[model samples]
Target: MKNTTIALLGATGKAGRYILKHLINRGYTVKALLRKPDGLDFRHPKLVIVPGDVRDAETVSDWTAGCTAVVSALGQTPGEPLVSALAARHVINAMQQHNIKRYIFLSGLTVDVQGDHKSEANQAKSNWMRQHYPDVVNDKQQAYQLLSQSTLEWTMIRLPWIEQTEQRRNLAINLHDCPGDVISTADLAAFIAQELSSATYVHKAPFVASI
Candidate 1:
């Protein structure tokens, strides 16, 4: 882990901040790419906050130049397609240009198209989203498709509804299904940190959380 330099995109977000704290505490040098570096409160000796949008290919490539891996907690708000698509494309190109193979992205559970191993609750949730927020789901699915087809060694963590809870890090992982469990942001950060240290699910997306 000492030799690995991580370039974390969306470092100002809720989950990104947690990952930043974990990386800093573990003595890993992280280059955090955010929309505004000045707005962030966390300052660490090992943390380098780079001000930029994830949609900018040049900026993304510059930030990831010497990085061993990349972690993206990037997402879009409801009814926003441009930002999500642009950022996904930029990340893909940036990783390709820099030859940084490892990538871990946070995608929602609703993006899972395959129905294998899906619990009843998960199925219902998917149906609900399909009936209500179809556009948001479609946008996320497109982002996942881009990552899946890329040559980059990427793992898309399809997270369930996240809550800030006080629980142990005892989450179950599924390859193509939801875990039917809620997860805390802290626990998610711990899992991401663990994945960063070890290349367990490279090139494979998995559902994660404590059941």
Candidate 2:
């Protein structure tokens, strides 16, 4: 996927940072969209930092115009609802307007409304997430619903618990079941990078990471 211009939303967070590094190292032109694009000067030759919030439709639309694909690593913290949904809405609108069809979004495994036979631990965790972060999960579910119904070739990677570790190798990729107990951030980043070039999960919401 050399020369593919990827517009990455939330390009400064944990997973976003790893994705940026992998994209740069793999020689892909990156246009990083961030709410606060100050003080982050990776200074990589292949990186183009676009300083704007994803909530701004016009700004995101402009950035999406010339990009081959869009990757959203957007998330919601404890007390932020409007901001998170607004960003996701803007991303969807911009991609729609520009006719950019390939989108990969980072969502949680609990967003699965179907409740397919997941492990008991996963179910318990989902229950906990629903209790504590109900609004955030609901927002993500709304986002997933919108994306799933859209015409764009979108893939929502619903990941398990994410960890920051030095082990940076590709674990087994699965479509339905969780792959392992924990997923390293590096491995997740590598998976996203691989998906940029392949359609292993096109238009399919897959629960990822190692089981």
Leading candidate by TM-score: 2
In candidate 2 the C-alpha lDDT for residue 52 amounts to 80
User: Candidate 2 on 86-135: residue-level lDDT in tens?
Assistant: 66678888988888889998987778745367778887888899998788
**lDDT of candidate 1 at residue 46, scale 0 to 100:** 90
List the candidate 2 regions with Cα displacement exceeding 4 Å. 39-41, 113-115
TM-score per prediction, in order, is: 0.90, 0.92
Model 1 scores a TM of 0.90
Q: Quote the lDDT for 112 in model 1.
A: 72
Error of 2 at 137 (Å): 0.9
Model 1, residue 190: what's the lDDT? 85
